[model samples]
Target: MVAEKITQCMKPHGEEGYQTIENMNENHKEISDFAFECVNVGENDKILDIGCGGGVNIEKFLKLTSGNVDGLDYSGVSVNASIRQNQNAVESGRCNVIQADVSDMPIDDESYDLVSAFETIYFWPDIANTFKEVSRIIKPQGQFMIAQGTDGNHPDDELWLSTVEGMSVYTADELEKYLLNAGFKSVKSFKKENDYILIVIAKK
Candidate 1:
């Protein structure tokens, strides 16, 4: 049911026929790139990436920073695929990939300088609990960021949101409210085309 639930939202046609990466590149890359560009990775900052997928984005950080980088995803396929794609980073100890559910990450509290979730949160079964866990794993003044589509952005938005109960195009105000409620000090967002994607920078 867990796989079914999440995959249903990702699949444009059916779960088995879904090619998330391929579909995304066609219509959602601009939004994804926009959010990804906000990372602002300074030297010596520890970074954590939730739902690392195939590690294309994680590789960007690994190449940009000399500091430690880690990623977690619920899908074993995704984690392994990422590991294979970024084997250099893994071999150099600059990056690591783990299989974990967002709501129950294996990382310790205050462990990272930045945490990012790219196209990942809408599938979360409990956003509050996941936010709490992500917040707990960052240091003071550490940040948590998410890259997501806004209303009327991605062509599949309506179907995706419909199949997944809590899935949404989070407004900046709504994101701020939720992040603040989850103990983040601040939250802000931006727009890409019709998509109102959030690049939340929440300080602990």
Candidate 2:
């Protein structure tokens, strides 16, 4: 029951899911901040944030860029929450959020300069296919950033892995291998302190 509840919150479904996403936004601030610091966002670059929960990152991305930012999530609840959170940007046409899965995103080819996935890839059904989709939407030399609180080597990850169905934390090296297999030309990873928090930067 505990695992089921956690999984539901991770993907979120209804009113309760909205609250969970809000909680996640508050809790994930540190990793997100660290991830952004590891890269530079061009003033006029289109960005797509995958698995965008509560639209917090999307809001931040809007402030960081003069160009547009888009968000995609598999959960309708998350989609609604992100829309509500970034209503002003959406109204002004600077941001757009959609309900969709990562493996088959409904975005145009080479449409974005950067793509981000934060604390969400663990739930993707097929990481490889999803990476391919992410690659498709990115322009030449575009970057894909993945930020996670767990680097797959954390001692606590075993507990979460046992409890959470379909949750698979990965090491920076493992992610780098997959990213390269998906057509990314180069990949680099960063660590925050001694914690399991890892940020991967992949260029296509």
Candidate 3:
């Protein structure tokens, strides 16, 4: 029953799912901040945040750039929550939140200066292919940033893996290999001291 509940993190829906997103927004903040520090955000750089969840990160991105920020999530509940969180940006045409899968996005080719995935890729299917899709939407010399709470070496990794359905964790090395295979020109990774936080940046 606990594992089933945990599965809500995969494709959140309903009230429980909504609550899960809210919790994640708060829980993932520190790791997200670490990620922000590793990437450069230009005032006019457009950004697309995958698995935008409650849209808290989108709110932060709006402050960092004068250009638009968009969000994509497969969960409709998450989409609604994100839209609500960034309602003003949406109203002013500064943001668009779409409910769509990572493997097949509706964005135009080379559309963004930066693409980010935060605490979300563990639930992705065929991750390498998804990276290709991410690459497709990023402009040349643009970047893809991935932030995770684990590098597959956390103390509770096994427990979470056993409990959450379809969830997987990868080390920085493994992820780097996949990113390179997906056509990224270069990849750099950072790990927090004495912590499980991992940030990987891939340039196209």
Candidate 4:
């Protein structure tokens, strides 16, 4: 029963999922902020947040960039929450929340200046191919940033893996390899001091 609730982190659904997303927004703030500090955000840079649960990060991006800030999530519930969280931006034509999968995003080629994945990607199907899809949508020389609470060495890693269905964790080395193979030119990773937080930035 507990495991089922944990699975909602992959693709949130109904009422329980809604609560999970809200919790994620609050819980993930620090890591998200750390990620932002690591990357450069231009005043007019277009941005996309993949697995943009509850749209908290989207709201953050809106403040950093004058260009459109879009969000994509596979879960309908998440999409709705994101839209609600950024309603003013959406209504003002500065934001768009889309329901889509990472492996096959419907966005146009070379559309964004920055693409970010936060506290997500453990549940991605075919991660290598999905990275390629991310590459396809980013403008040349644009960047991709990934931030999560684990570097795959956390004390509770095994417990979470066992508890959450289809969840997987990747080390910084593994992520760098995948990003490079998927066409990123260079990859740099940062680990928070005395913490498990991992942030990787890949340039295309």
Candidate 3 at 164: error in angstroms?
A: 0.8
Clashing residue pairs for model 1: 110-138, 150-196
Report clash pairs, candidate 3: none
lDDT tens readout by residue for model 4, 126-191:
999999999999999999999999999999999889888779999999999999999999999999
lDDT of 4 at 56: 93
C-alpha lDDT values of all predictions: 0.72, 0.90, 0.94, 0.94
Clashing pairs in 4: none
Question: Which lDDT value does model 1 have at 141?
Answer: 86
Off by over 4 Å in 4: 1-5
| Model 4, C-alpha of 13: deviation from truth (Å) | 0.6
Which candidate do you rate higher for TM-score, 2 or 3? 3
Distance from true location, Cα of 168 in model 2, Å: 0.7
- Write the number of the candidate with greater lDDT, choosing between 2 and 4: 4
Report clash pairs, candidate 2. none
What RMSD, rounded to one decimal, does every model reach? 4.1, 1.5, 1.4, 1.5
The candidate, 2 or 3, that scores higher on lDDT is: 3
Show the lowest summed lDDT stretch of 10 residues, model 4. Answer: 1-10
How do the predictions measure up, each by TM-score?
Answer: 0.82, 0.96, 0.97, 0.97
